[model samples]
Target chain A: MTVERSAPPTISEVAAEAGVGRATAARTLGGYGYVSPELRSRVLAAAERLGYRANALARSMSTGVSHTLGVIVADIGNPFFAGVVRGISDASRARGFDTIVLSTHESLDEEIAAMHVLIDKQVDGIVVASAALGPKTSAHIAEAWSRGIPVVLVDRAVPGLELDAVVIDNREAAREAVTALIAAGHRRVGFVWGPPIAGRPDRRRDLVDAAARNLWTDGERLRGYLDALDDAGLPFDADLVMVGEKTEERAIAEVERMLGLDDRVTALFCTETDAVTGALRAIRATGFRVPADVSLIGFDDSSWAAVMEPPLTMIEQPMLALGTRAAEVLLALIDGAPRSQPDGAFRHTLDTRLVERSSVAPPSA
Target chain B: MTVERSAPPTISEVAAEAGVGRATAARTLGGYGYVSPELRSRVLAAAERLGYRANALARSMSTGVSHTLGVIVADIGNPFFAGVVRGISDASRARGFDTIVLSTHESLDEEIAAMHVLIDKQVDGIVVASAALGPKTSAHIAEAWSRGIPVVLVDRAVPGLELDAVVIDNREAAREAVTALIAAGHRRVGFVWGPPIAGRPDRRRDLVDAAARNLWTDGERLRGYLDALDDAGLPFDADLVMVGEKTEERAIAEVERMLGLDDRVTALFCTETDAVTGALRAIRATGFRVPADVSLIGFDDSSWAAVMEPPLTMIEQPMLALGTRAAEVLLALIDGAPRSQPDGAFRHTLDTRLVERSSVAPPSA
Candidate 1:
């Protein structure tokens, strides 16, 4: 299994062979100022002979900027992240910056690895859309900031991080979606929730006790749904709630099990597009017509939502805007602009609109 | 809108400010071989005052290697490419290499842009899955070779380019699929062909033109179908032929239009999974029973193909193997290994297999 190692030679070796002081060899090999042609030739030849390659990390330590940006996402397979990546790529290209994209897959270790990679590469800035931030990940980003590398949080915000961020108002968007469903006459609505990992420590506690107290996005959304229900004089039914894993198959199975209950949900509110798709498939399998046997509403208006049979009623989040704004902020930081927020907590809240489609209707009698 | 530019300081200014000869300043700032500590300190102080950053591209030209890899794909949105990219990332990460991924969007200009970016970045190597290559693109890769940077062609093999490549036998796979259809008593068969584009030139012309000449994979598959038809005394009819753009919408539309023809197609063979999905949608739309009214077969046994309703019968290409092999070849080239082939054209073709499922059956009366 062993392949020939193609590792580049070390700087010390190149210096020794170049027959010059280490400092002189370093500067000449690195293409820094003040190297004569003869010395430059000697150093380059020696370095080439020794296969010495310049280390970008060391170079970044000397210079304030690395001309590289780090982009971290929860998952690459999700078309949402893919679209955001496209936007980042376009923006970064326009700014003549290169990006190092990493998929965290919702793992803290992976997120940490991504941060380390970016730090090692000495990226000028970092844009992250994490599931949640661990203390270590937060510390790593803070360290990079101390070294003058700007970090911009995207989608997921880490509380107390004091970094610029671009995000949609998830709680407001969710509440609006739930309010719409309630307005459409859904009395008994079930919810499919996302993983309860909060990005900030202050928010983490709220998320942990979300079932008891109002969390940021999820709790606020739930409160909105409840408020709408209360406004309609409908009692909130706990039994109607179903929590499922994010995968389509698992979500569908959870929905099927929930539906088999004695008093099944009359309508459903999917917290994410994946949940929506899964619920639809399960309902279809049971021969239930959308908005007939059960009305449904979903968050995140994904591309496939419009193409699905009966289409889909969804709350659309501005994914591209979020990505573009994050890039702009990072570029601004790279340009040595004053931080937008004195507290280092810059946030942008985008409006979400509900797209009414055949997937939602008054609950059937 | 005009944005403020934040360009880094140049090396020449750093040398002048350091009060040293240009050669001395370069040697001191570059951090490689030899310089007095006093001279190094003065050079560093000057560089810090002026904010000088070395030009990586120019440095890469003088040196032999750049610690970067370029990756080009026809379409990043395709789940297949996503899977391949995942493999590439995993492999590249294990070796501590950074990759710059580019999407061609099936356009030649974009593909050329990808090449130019990699060249400008002075990347150590490149891996590409091109839509088509003109002389210019070929020349760029050859130029990289002359500059001692390794290039590995992935999926697409250019015949004229003396480079290493990883690919699958598309024709043989197609033939196998058609042969399976023949085995299942399908005679009046039709094909949904891939778009006419040469992603690589070194590939056998017959294979590349299989859909047109009906010679390599496309042709061989057609031959297998023809053999089955001739053996069953079923004359090949051109009326059943349908060509579709790469999109599922177009494929479905083409299939629907072909079904409206007088003769009608009894069985279908699609060249790609997207086309197969489209054909299935069309068949369902027309209320036709799969494998009963019109049997079907597809290429590229995608993850969803097997999970679809009735499951798909398809030819499976070794996707992960293709990616891994391409990486291996590029890594080898980066290690300065001599070309395996004397003429410098190295190509490896993996086998493809037919996976039978519920999609194919004899045509109904």
Candidate 2:
């Protein structure tokens, strides 16, 4: 090999400087097979002195451990995902690992591509807030697992996948939020966001069927909304629930149509940040007042929520905790920890807190 | 070598199945040395049939190109950086490249460690919003460049480093914002969030000296503030400037202190998101009204700013463009494009839009 002092020092140069065999130096620096303590120290010291850094790819190929975690989220620009990524990065860094984050823009095809990339890179583990919902859609994830790279799901869970998951009790959280609206004497409550249904639901069964075919979180939250209506002995009004693609523009149009109905929605339950913002904009455009003409409750509290006209009452998800727990679980699996439950999965259901400010009140006459 | 049917296919297995030599298979699959079109197609077809995937680590070692990029930012949780990352990720994905993101929390040591990790990963290039300042603090970046991995900076630039940088003209942005406040007939304008300095400054020279030792954006913005004051022939009042750690609590406390000063500040210019939030909270807590009691102008517009009681006027940064331009420059470099400028560096200065809302009004006597 050519000895070029200007380029980064090679392993052979490090070995020569350490007065050890190249094989020993490779084993010590690559963190694979055994090397005597003395020889390891000598090689490490020589590496530091020569500014020699081991290539992670070569090391990963030999040891099957990249000391890196891969995270795939829907969109990193969204505040919720941003917080979750921060938690995962902080937790992973503290545990002596690096993280690679990829955003799929909620596309299944992109998610598949990202999964393939992660597997090719040989990450030690993965934490995913998956866009895939069922077994067929999640074949890429299963392929990664079969290759021995464990994956931990966060924010959402997939059916028929026996893997550790960190998520909030979406059903219970939605139930509690809707129950509060009912307790405030609201007979007509609107659900502003739900699963990506193909058409508007004209009956309760339509929602139930759509939920079954979509994401686990969406299905659970829809059930929670239905539960609250049942608890109040109120009939589920299909017109009061917004369906189809959950976009801000669609949310505003749907909310406007609902408000203009012969029987108006007395209050609204929004399950996401964009939904809340869209709802507020619609309310303002329709010349309605909050907690007076229409009471509102939203999910995912932010700094702006606290500074709104009357402030906002929100259900705050444990976003950071979800991310931290996912990383921790993935790291444990990477260390060869056995699954604790009989189903061979670790289900960590975190709690969400209701922050009551001034936005919720009795429905106006 | 022994082969197992249950395991992922190996290169050797692909070579045997394709009726080619091992070296030919390696060259074809690893995307390195040239192979005849006939043999290359045969190897690729065989690999596809056997579900053989190329390991990025092994391929990178052979070809010196991972087709991946590394990004280092202050915090992924922050809205500004979140938008920037989204742009970078989207742009990189369009070019068929994967990105690895890391957050430094504005810590120099963490930035250094992140740089080292990226180098070891053998990424084709890096895009960074650096936490390092002068040559002493920026040695790690230079080292990476010298080793053939190009780095493109975004958001902030470092002095004495000849490298491509994507940034807004921060000095001009701040100057225009401050000039707007002055045009509103406000002479005593408070400048919130400056460089992190020790002890309170009693003279303009103190701030000038501190700027030289801190971040490039901070220094430029500070210079712009000074420029606006000079244009109005207003004597620089050190008492109106808030320095040191730019935390939310400090911003609130300093604004409160400024309002209570013998020569009260008639308007406030906040240079960051947190500063604006803190200033608003302080104004509310002090029983002062925005615009009527004190006019405000802030940097970095967000959705919350538009939804405020009286919509805020802000300097809207090209956050996404910054990331996109940085990625484009880095990609060009990775593709061996020559620098356009004679100085051997690409300096992309994007413009900022000044969105005038209802936040500014004539200050009350």
Instruction: Pick the TM-score winner.
Output: 2
Q: Give all TM-scores, in the order shown.
A: 0.68, 0.86
DockQ of each: 0.11, 0.29
Compared with the true structure, what per-residue lDDT tens digits does model 1 show for residues A1-365? 11233644444556677887666675675555578888888888887777665554444445545566778887665656766776776688679776557776666667766675565455678888854443434766665564456788887666656767677766666667777777877767776653333331233234335532322345546555666666677776554554334577766876776677787777788876567767877886777777778888887775345534556788887777777888888898889887657675678766678888778788776
List the global CA lDDT of all models: 0.66, 0.84
Quality class of the docking in candidate 2, CAPRI style? acceptable
Question: Candidate 1 at residue B350, lDDT?
Answer: 78
The lDDT leader among the candidates is: 2
Please provide, for model 1 over B268-359, each residue's C-alpha lDDT reduced to its tens digit, 9 standing for 90 to 100. Answer: 88876567767877887887777778888887775445434555687787776777777777887788776558564667887777888888
Per-residue alpha-carbon lDDT of candidate 2 for residues B244-329, written as tens digits (9 for 90 to 100): 68888889988999999998998999998888988887888898888899999999998778767677999999988888889999
lDDT of 2 by residue, A72-144 (tens): 9988888899899888988999899988888888888888888877877778899999877777688787777
Q: Give TM-scores of chain A for all candidates.
A: 0.77, 0.85
Q: Given candidate 2, what's the lDDT at residue A114?
A: 83
Candidate 1: residue B312 lDDT (0-100): 66
Q: Give residue B151's error in model 2 in angstroms.
A: 1.3
Report how far off residue A354 is in candidate 2 (Å): 0.6
